[model samples]
Target: MATTAVINGERLWSALMAMAEIGRTPAGGVRRLALSDEDRRARDLLVEWLREAGCAVRVDDLGNIYGRRDGDDAGATAVVCGSHLDTVPTGGRFDGVLGVLAALEAVRAMRDADLRTRRPVEVVCWTNEEGVRFAPAMLASGVVCGRFTVDEAHAARDQDGRTFGEELRR
Candidate 1:
């Protein structure tokens, strides 16, 4: 016999719809540039939802958000999941957000099922993935993995002459 983990499709759809409304474009797409006010709201909502699902949340220096859910072992390598939350200036509803929301839904489903795995699980929301607003896409994840330096990323500027670090600090 195989056990199945059930997830609420309606809940996931609602969450996606809610996120889409934050930076909705005139053409029915999203325009959530990284470090923008709309992006901040979406980030806050993700943190709130993660908290409601009982995850320990933290935001890194480069603005990557991590939500960890503990499993049987206390000191184990986590099974990481998730993707960037930021989208291009006029991106579709599911562009990068679906991966983030799917990870959240997985955590929610695990919580609902009371399932326990051997290793911990963590969901990460990477920052500044779309280069439309900030130069050099995948900045946060690259900085973490040593592919790019923090100083390099911080110095990156937008079309409006605002630095990545400046927007991050705002």
Candidate 2:
């Protein structure tokens, strides 16, 4: 899709609403816990939209998703922008969701306008950001940024004894 036809406020709002619809609580909060079906669905939906906008998408072992726009130089670091898709058990609508969708919307707008930067742009979605399921927050980013080891993240368990590695598989 072209950048001009990409980022529409209506569409963005609709997408946000759609994500909110998953695991919606009576009080207008979302309960899509990390690695749950709802979380996976939301992640998949975002990746689908990213692909539609000509982004090359990849997910790290810990489920840190990256949607990249190809750049002239393959070696350039991406101008990445995004937050997390995972939400708390009683999470508000905006929170980190807006940050993730906004980055995607920006990419769509850029594509529609045929805009290009010296470095490629990436729309990212980090996993388990809220830590509602895994205890500590930013587990994925911690691993990705070298703040923590993959083994350490894998050892993380929820209140129910489920490990982060097992959750990522689901």
Candidate 3:
């Protein structure tokens, strides 16, 4: 059977615009610092979208979001794609947001195309990737890949002297 997979650019653009509004700055940049209220809202919106697209969403202690579309073999490893949602104080709308939205669009396209694969597909959102509020970028991803420890990531402090773990729990 012939199948088609087409990305809805308009839908992707709409999603981007919607997210860009979350932490909108006066200078047209986003200030969605990690674990902040803006970050939480963005996470909630993304999770809602993922579930709407038929994915099972999970968030870790470090606040990494994974939206999974199961495959025929539930035990198989997943093919994942995504980027962080949190941004620096002056982060552009397209920097990390585009990759995330594109991945979301891919999942949506797959659903539209009725595509199937042996391995599950997932969209991931890494936490504190910019390190604006926390030190050392790629914090959550580094921990998952062993570059950093959970304690180290949690110990990171912001300008107000609040620990990363403290804000995450807030």
C-alpha TM-score for every candidate: 0.95, 0.93, 0.96
Alpha carbon lDDT of each predicted model: 0.91, 0.87, 0.92
> How many Å off is the CA of 63 in candidate 1?
0.2
Residues 17-59 of candidate 3: C-alpha lDDT, one tens digit per residue: 9999999999999989999999999989999999999999998
Off by over 4 Å in 2: 1-7
Error of 1 at 87 (Å): 1.1
Query: 1-170 in candidate 2: lDDT tens per residue?
Result: 24343568997898899888877889999888889998899999999999998999999889989999987777898888999878877899877889999999988888878876668899999999998899689988988888889989988999999999998886
Query: What is candidate 2's TM-score against the reference?
Result: 0.93
Measured with C-alpha atoms, the lDDT of residue 104 in candidate 1 is 94
Q: Say which candidate scores most in lDDT.
A: 3
TM-score: model 1 vs. ground truth: 0.95
Q: State the displacement of the C-alpha of residue 55, model 2, in Å, after optimal TM-score superposition.
A: 0.5
Evaluated at residue 149, the lDDT of candidate 2 is 92
Candidate 1 residues 1-170, lDDT tens each? 12455788999999999999999999999989999999999999999999999999999889999999998998889999999778887799998899999999998988888888779899999999887788788988999999999899999999999999999999
Estimate the lDDT of model 2.
Answer: 0.87
Clashes of each: 0, 7, 0
